[model samples]
Target: MTSAKRVAIMVTCMVDQVMPEVGVAAVRLLRRAGYTVEFPAEQTCCGQPFFNSGFRAQAADLAKRSLDIFEPYDAVVLPGGSCAAMIRKEYPHLLERWPGGVARAEALAARTYELSEFLVHVAGWQPAPAAGAPRVTYHDSCHMNRLLGLGAESRALLSAAGCAIVEMHESDRCCGFGGVFSIRIPEVSNAMTQEKVRRADATGAEVLVSADPGCLMQMRGFAHQTGMRLAHLAVLLEELTR
Candidate 1:
C-alpha cells in the first residue's frame, strides 16, 4: 500500500492532445484536496482503444507499461472516466494470461479511481459554495456510469458546489463517443450526440457537464445547435471553486 497523501494523475489521450486544460484543472482540484500530485511524463494511452478494437496483445503491452509507471503511487486518479474504467475494469482481464499479471493488475485497479470518485470518497473534500452558482445539466458517460457505477458521486459534487442540478432526460444514455466507435460509425454517433444535446438544451441549463472527456468531445461537435455551454466536470469544479 502506498501513502494516502501521494497521488498520480492519468491524463488520458483526449485530454493530453485535445483538451489539455482539463488536465490542468484536475491537478488544481487534487492540490486543493490536500494531495501531493505527480504526473509521470512517460504516461500515455491506457491501451483502451486497442483493447476496444480487439488488439488484445497491443493493449496488454500498454497495460503493463501503465502498471509499471503508475503502480508506485498510493492512488491513481484520472480526469477521464473511460480511461479510469479501462484500468480498473479491463486491465486484469487484459493481462490475465501473463505470469503474475492478474495479481498486479488487480492491485493497480484497487488504487485507481475516477476524479470525482477520488474527490468525494477518498479526499472527503467538498467545495465552498460558488458565488452565483450556474444552472447545469450532467451527462453520464458509459464507462463511468455502467462500468464504474458512479453517476451520483459527480452530481453530489456539483450540488455541493452550489450549482442548480437540472436533470436532463436520459442522463445516463450513451453520448455515442465510444472512442473508436464514433470514428467507425460517425453517422450513428452524430445522431446519438444530437439527441443528447437536444435533451440538455431542453433542460434550459446554462452548461452541460460531464466527467468523461470522450463524451464532452462527442457532444461538443453539436455545440452549434445547443444554447448551453459544454464543460468537463473538473474544469467546471475548478472554475466554481475559484
Candidate 2:
C-alpha cells in the first residue's frame, strides 16, 4: 500500500532456472499494484526438495538457509502454489521434525503468501474485463488447493483478467508429478497425468491453465503426446496485460 510495504519474490528453483520470465512477470504485477518489490538472490531452494526426497537433514539445513535469506522481508510471495504451500504449510512440519525447526519455520511462514492469494485477497485486485476469449481450464495444484486452501483466488484472478474459466471435470485431481513421486514411479505418474489431460480435453478448452510448472511439465508432456495444447497460469496472466 505504500513505500514501506516491502515484498520479496520467492523465485522457486523451477522458476529460477526454467522460467525466469514468470518471476519477472510476478515482480511487474506486484510493482504495478504499488508494492516495492525486491529479489533476494541469496535465497535458494525452499527445502521441499530434500524434505520430499526423504532427506530430512538436508531439508532442515536448506530450510535454515531459506529462512535466513527471506526472513527480513515484510511479505514473501511465490508464483507456484506447491512452493508457496511448502512455505505456508509443509515447512513447519519438516522443520519441527528435528531440533529448532518449528520456531524457525513458523517465523518464516508467517510472512509468506501465494501471489494470487495476496493479489486478490490482500490487494483487493479488481478483475479486468473479459472479451470473447479462448476456452480456458485450470488444473488446481494439489498443494495449493488441498494444502494451502487457496480456493478460487487463482480462478478469480483469471476470470477478472477476462479468460473463460472452464471446470476440467475433476479440477481438484492430482496430476501425479508429486516431486519425487514421479521419478519413483514414472508409469504411475504418466497414467495419472493422462487422465488429467483427457479431462481437460473434455472441456473443449483450447488451453489448460495450471499454477505450478511441475504439473505443467507433466501435463504438457501428455498434451504433447496427445497433440493437445496447454498453458500455465503465469503465461496466461502475462497475456492478459498485453
Candidate 3:
C-alpha cells in the first residue's frame, strides 16, 4: 500500500474543549483521503478570541506560538473556518511587524487550508458512495464566507457526497458566534442565533451543517427547542461517506 501524505490538524479551541468529535471526524476524512494526520501537542487557541477581544499582544503571542508548531508541515488543516481564516487571512496582517514575522506568517498562511478546501482542492478527494442521501442545509460562518470566501467548497463537497443541498433564507447570514461578541452582547447574539435556526428550520432539511464549531455550538443552543439537528460538515460528511 502507498504511504499517506502527512498533514497537521489544527483543532480549534472550541473543538478541543467542547466538540472534539468534529476533530475526530476531520482526521478520519483526511485519513481516508490518504493523509497521515498529526495534532501538535503544543497547539492551543488560534489567538482569534484574544484578537477579536482586542488583546493584540496576547493574540500576537499566540499566533507566533502557533506558527512555530505548524511551520514545519507542508500542509495544515483546520476543522473550523473561523480559526482557519484567522491563520490564513489575519495572521500576516496581525504579525506585520515584530522582526521577520511577516515572512513567517505569510509562509504559514500559504500552506493552510480549510478542511473541505483541502479535501477538494489539495487532496482531490471524492468521497465513497453513500447508501442514501440526506437532505441538509448549510450555514456559512462569517469568517468562512466573507473572509475565506469558502462558501462554495463545503457545498460542493456535500453535493459530491450525495447530500441534497437546500438553500436556506439568508444562508450566508451570521449565526452571531463571533467569539467574544456572543459573550459581550448575549442578547443580540442569542437573537441572531434564533433567527438563524428559524431560517434553517424553514428549509425542512434533516440536518443543518456548518464548517465552524462556533456557529454549530451557537445554533445548537436553539436547535433542540426548534426541532433541528445540527452537525459540523466533517461529521456530516463522515457519516454520509461511511
Candidate 4:
C-alpha cells in the first residue's frame, strides 16, 4: 500500500499533449486537498487507442509498462475519465494472458480513480462556493458515465463549487469522441457533436464542462458555432477553490 497522503497523477496523452492546463489544475486541486502529488515522468498512454483499434499486443505492452510505472503509488488519479476507465476496467482483460498479469492489473485498478472521484470519495473535499459562479452545463463522457458509473460525482462537485447547474437534455449522451471513432467516422461524429453542442447551447449555460478531455476537444472543435465556453471539470474546480 502506498502512503495515504501521496498520490500519483496520470495526466494521460490528451492532457499532456493538448490540454495540459487540465493536468496542472488537477495537481492544484489535489494539493489543495492536502495530498503530495507525484507525476511519474515515464507515464504515457494507457493503450485505449490501441485496444480500441484491435491492436491487442501493442495495448498489452503499454498496459504492462503502465502497470510497472504506477504500481508503487498508494493511489492513482487521472483528470480524464476515459483513461481512468481504461486502467480500471480494461487493464485486467488486456493483461490476462501474461503470467500473473491479471492479478497485477487488478491490484492497480483498485487503487486508481478519476479526479473528481478521488476528490469527492477519497478526500471528502468540499469547496467554498464561488462568488458569482457562472451558470454551466456538464457533459458526461461515455467511458466515465457508462463504463465507470460516475455520473453524479462531478455534478455534485460542481454544485459544491457554487456553479448553477443547468441540466442539458440527455446530459449523458456521448459527445462522439470515441478517440479513433471520431477519425474513423467524421461525418457521424461531427453530427453527434453538433447535436450535443446544440443541446448545451439550448440550456443557455455560459460554460460547457466535462471531466473527459476527449469530449472537451471534440466539442471544442464545434464550439465556435455557439457562444458557450468549454472547460474541464478540474480546471473549473481549481479556479473555484482558489
**All candidates' TM-scores?**
0.98, 0.92, 0.97, 0.98
TM for candidate 4 is: 0.98
Off by over 4 Å in 3: 1-4
lDDT of 1 by residue, 1-242 (tens): 43469899998988999999999999999999999899999998999999998999999999999999998888999998899999999999899999999999999999999999999999998999998989999999989999999979899999999999999999999997888889999899899999999999999999999999989988999999978899999999999998
Q: Can you write out model 3's per-residue Cα lDDT over 160-195, one digit (the tens) per residue?
A: 888889999999899977889999999999999999
Return the TM-score for candidate 1, rounded to 2 decimals: 0.98
lDDT of 1 at 127: 95
2 or 4, which is superior by TM-score? Answer: 4
| Candidates by lDDT, descending order | 4, 1, 3, 2
CA lDDT of every candidate? 0.93, 0.81, 0.91, 0.94
Model 3, total clashes: 0
Q: What alpha-carbon RMSD in Å does predicted model 2 have with respect to the real structure?
A: 2.0
Candidate numbers, best TM-score first, in rank order = 4, 1, 3, 2
RMSD in order of candidates: 0.9, 2.0, 2.0, 0.9
Count of steric clashes across candidates, in order: 0, 2, 0, 0
